[model samples]
Target: MKQMTLKTTSDLSLAIAKDRFSRGTLWRFPARVPLLLLVTGLCLQMPAVWAQQQETPGKAAIPQESPFGTYGSFEKLLQAAQGGDADAQVKVSLCYGKGIGVTQDYEKAFTWAMKAAEQENAGGASIVAGCYLQGKGVEQNIPQAIEWVTKAANRGDVMAQYNLAATYYEGLYGIPKDEEKAFFWAEKAANQGDREAQCLLGVCYLTGKGVTKNLEKSAYWSQKASDQGAPAAQRNMGIFYAMGLGGLKKDVNKALELWKKAAEAGDSEAQYALGSCYAGDVEYYDPDKIYQNMPEAKKWLQKAADQGHERAKETLERLFHIKASS
Candidate 1:
């Protein structure tokens, strides 16, 4: 019998770390690849109003009748903000930062965001962290970015929790890699119904990184995110169904359905898996039922290869005798 060595979650963690160091972006995996990749943390930066909603659950309903609601003309927002309304400060900062109704001015945006942050507003803290992370209006200071983000996360800011989880998971921005802390933040965010965090937590449980290895738990969390249309979690769920892992019964049809959904969402890994399935290379499918469609295979494999999926490129050259460069 061939000894099957189970790859751990650390493999995924290290891949994420390397990808972050090189690309300064999120990690993505090739389709059907054994290793999992972390979802990019870029989505952690929510719009100011959205951030406010996530941070302050069950607060007074945001007034929609006011011209100075979460968003409005720059002049009115500026006037309200100048009057020291924390919510207005956030809107005015966004106006300056994005040039929605005014000229883009990072310095002014930072100033206003800082004012709100000083008042302990979660949205303000998140913006301040983002400015520091990207050096928008201030000099790039990774430590400061992390500090502000941490403040927001501690205050039940879901996006902040997700960002901190990604940061700790990959140890990006000069932070030390800590799987335990990553799991902590991810779990917090996941419990709050953050899809990305749910996916990360599922992976953690699947691989026993900062959590006990529990395939059932992995499936549970992945399903939650997948139901919410998170592509990564959908892909993970497909893998679980295909392999019959995570307490799921082997269901090729279900796996293919999930993979197709993820592939349509532009997940490179799902594209590759779909290609492999069409190519009749995936194990457990009946040989007679496996239809070899080279064109379909090439289509999806090309999509993955275009995204720099090394194995897809290799498979194209070696098996399909086609050069991806072409």
Candidate 2:
């Protein structure tokens, strides 16, 4: 809803883009906050300028418009960036960083993003924090990254809050572990409908990390996140249904259904669940007889084993006599 403006540059620098990306930071961790790398394309994309290359009189044509981003042609986006829309400023920053409708310029991206952040926009502030964290346009500064992200979290940026929660939860980035802080931020993001945060909040409640363990609360949050297609939540929801935990009646069929969804979505744990269950290890009560003979048992189990799930690998060897080398 806001307009943005920025200094226009005709500079087409694929070399610059490549250089920035060469140094770009994208990290994923099973035990820590993910640095929001999965949100690469959450912003609105410009039209299909990607089909045609824009050539300058003396400059080589820039890369095709990235399918990943930008909302309009470069000229129009620049017009908006040059105005003063905080949201638009962030989008322009995304364009510059991603080489969407225009050439990549990390410095320009940082400038535009910071301008929006200065206006107290939560999304812009979070992007600035990401830039600092990743050293996209500036030197990597962990303290600066923490400061900016915390500021954005305080302003209720969902991603920022989720990142903060995960960081504190895992004691990552040199920060001391603080379950209270983790629970606090996780709750903030979860209440705002962030599925990942919802999944994490469920974990917190289930484990009693920052509050008393509450099965009902855990199941509630897990179901909420599962509805949004969160793999982790789906995995947990399956467990709840299978065990009849959290006030739910025993429903092995529902559990299998949820596990199938999670497994198909590439959740290693869910894959293991389906595999082990089908292999007759559930040896949990089942009247439906969705047994391993469906040939799903080995397939899902092998998928999990491929991901280095210890239990899955062991089960394959123990029951199926499948050798590890195979």
Candidate 3:
């Protein structure tokens, strides 16, 4: 078995010790690729230390005394980052901020994110803005946050674009609520594969917030967002499918799929839909295939109820009583 070691004094070594997240199973979308955001710490710091230690004293010189002696995944990738991988720099910074797989340390997060931002990494700039906004490791400053977010948004960081849109829409931190600016930033983010932005843009289209009202455009954007697994989009699509809007031709199967995706992602509306789907005995609907077992139906309904969905709350109470009697 090959072993790797890190020294306690090395900045790279400390970063490796802090990044431990591996995304277990909660992530499942193209947008979720940035969960790799948490992966940066582990990716940036392990290899160089190993190489240096290996070169010095073979197996004997490897420091087992350091706290990171046990990490085994992606050590080589981390080493590459330690050697100055820009992508790795951003990832490590994210890990520091969220404490995703490692100990939460704002100072390290700020430092690493700043390093990547200086290199013009949009993702890094977004995270750094978040830190500034929240006063995490740096002093709170909305102007600074906006500057960083704008930089990243301009560079096509979808998350940054979304934040920028929110800032402009709310007029937070002296920014005026310019609908055009909101639309501009949100559209930019949506185009860059941000599911939330897609859904928000769809909503904007539906309400004619920034752009003129266009139901077809709304449906188009909603579908785009839904396909990428946006919970809000799933809910919107489910509603559309249920209502047969925008020339959709109303497919129950498609509606069910969107609801399922939304429910799995913990959307209360989707959970309620799942309950409703099970309880309704429509002539063409396959209750067995859609809701299948009553127990799962109850589980989802209860989850929605807990989230304060009124319809779900009422449904769950009735279902619970029926189950008790049965």
Q: Could you say which candidate leads in TM-score?
A: 1
Q: What is the per-residue lDDT of model 1 for residues 1-326, given as tens digits with 9 covering 90 to 100? A: 11111122333221222323344442111111110010112232322112221222222233344433443456876887798877677666766665656777888888998898898877678778888877878887878888988887887777788778877877766679799999999899889887777888987887787888888998899999889777767877887887787788978778778988988877777777777777766555545555678798788888989888776787777667878873
TM-score for each model: 0.79, 0.77, 0.62
Candidate 1, which segments miss by more than 4 Å at Cα? 1-23, 26-72, 288-290
Q: Model 3, range 204-275, lDDT digits (tens) per residue? A: 677676898776787898898778666767877776675566568767778778878878977776777766
Model number with the top lDDT: 1
Query: Considering only N, C-alpha and C atoms within 3 Å, which residue pairs clash in candidate 3?
Result: 18-102, 20-101, 21-101, 40-91, 40-92, 41-92, 43-78, 47-79
**TM-score for predicted model 1 compared with the true structure:** 0.79
- lDDT to native, each model: 0.67, 0.64, 0.58
lDDT of candidate model 3 versus the reference? 0.58
lDDT of 2: 0.64
Give the per-residue Cα lDDT of candidate 1 at 276.
75
Query: Which window of ten consecutive residues has the lowest lDDT sum in model 1?
Result: 29-38
Better structure of 1 and 3 per lDDT:
1
